[model samples]
Target: MSSNRLKILHWSDYACPFCVIGDKRLNEVLEECNIKDRVDFEMKAYQLDKDAPKKPHLKMEEVFAKKFGISIEGARDRVDRIAGIGRNEGLDIKFATVQFTNTFDAHRLTKYIASQGKDVEKFIDLTFKAYFSDNLNIADRNLLIDIAEKAGIDKKDASKILKGKEFSDEVRKDEEEASDKGIRSIPHYIVNGKYVISSSEKSEMKFVLEQVLKDEAEGKLNINE
Candidate 1:
């Protein structure tokens, strides 16, 4: 944060619907403010349910109802509400048929892509679509390899990474750091390593990021990341 640009650390899960909404809104603000080049993004991985199975065995509503002790109707309402938000953002989020599965491999693959200085955002966006829109199983190695290749990653390299334990530590480190900070939410964004911003408040998010830019230009004291 004691640097010339604004730093954005976003902690989110690929399988989270709220993350889809938040990410879309945040990117909109960045583009609208015309501050894309003045900000740096570090997309950290955080799984809501780390123990989720590699393949979903139930409908999205059924799983939510069982997990939260709610009626199937109530669970459907919950998912539908989030889907409504995604619709407002012009996204296709079919949580009703979501393939809710373990995201460890997807997160690990993202870490590997970022480490290789590849198009991390493209890969992340593509993976998000695969889960929320296509209702595809992100934990599937073949699906991951396909998504990675479409994101401009080498198909062979992605296959090798998925076949082995590569970049797992990076994903774990992100999770551990979020835990130490007592962060228990997805689509959480930290600015300057201090101020927390959420896309849930669009005006506030725009204001906060713009303020960081102004403070940086003025040489104000910044909280270092």
Candidate 2:
């Protein structure tokens, strides 16, 4: 049978703690709405820092301080606030100690996972945990292969894909699409390709998603428009 499941395109990067928290909140709200099974989600690659080092260059606190021109102490305060949100969601995310490395390869891996007709949700969550909670170098091929293995991807296939340049174009394509849409932030979401739910509106996510689902069921969304 054919189903018109609510299609959600999410743009985010593993480097982002907000993406981690926002994703958790979204899922919780979806479950509350009882529409999780009726939704199809696709996570799009959106690099928070394309120029971030392939190796761990700086701790997230250092990056935070530099970006906002604040002291290390102040940076700790800011990132800790975000981390608290994750804790509330039962995610062990420590943003201050996050391994700030390039996430391009991680994004590529997600594209590869999707190509196999698999749901990338669990895989993406693991990547975030690896980068944030475990403080692992997501750019390291070896670490990524292990993460892939845990996500049910064959180790040999993961190694081959990471070793070569597989899914590079798809990663870049997602970035280009975000640019075309004038997106200037991580954790951007497009529902049914018409309704946009950015991080700023997270507090009302349940109500917003409920409306979207109701509209979708009523054939009111005309998503093609």
Worst 10 residues of 1 by lDDT: 1-10
The global C-alpha lDDT for each of the candidates, from Candidate 1 onward, is 0.86, 0.84
**Candidate 2 C-alpha error for residue 29, in Å:** 1.2
For every candidate, C-alpha RMSD to the true structure in Å? 2.3, 2.2
The sequence of per-residue lDDT tens digits that candidate 1 reaches over residues 1-225 is 332576789999988888878877888898887766767888998999999999788888988899899999999999899888889889999989888899999999999999889998899999999999889999999999999998889999999999999898889999999999888777789987877885456777788877876776787737466
**How far does residue 96 in candidate 2 sit from its true spot (Å)?**
1.5
Candidate 1 stretches with Cα past 4 Å from truth are 1-3, 221-224
The Cα error of candidate 2 at residue 152, in Å, is 2.2
lDDT of 1 at 202: 78
Model 1 steric clash pairs:
none
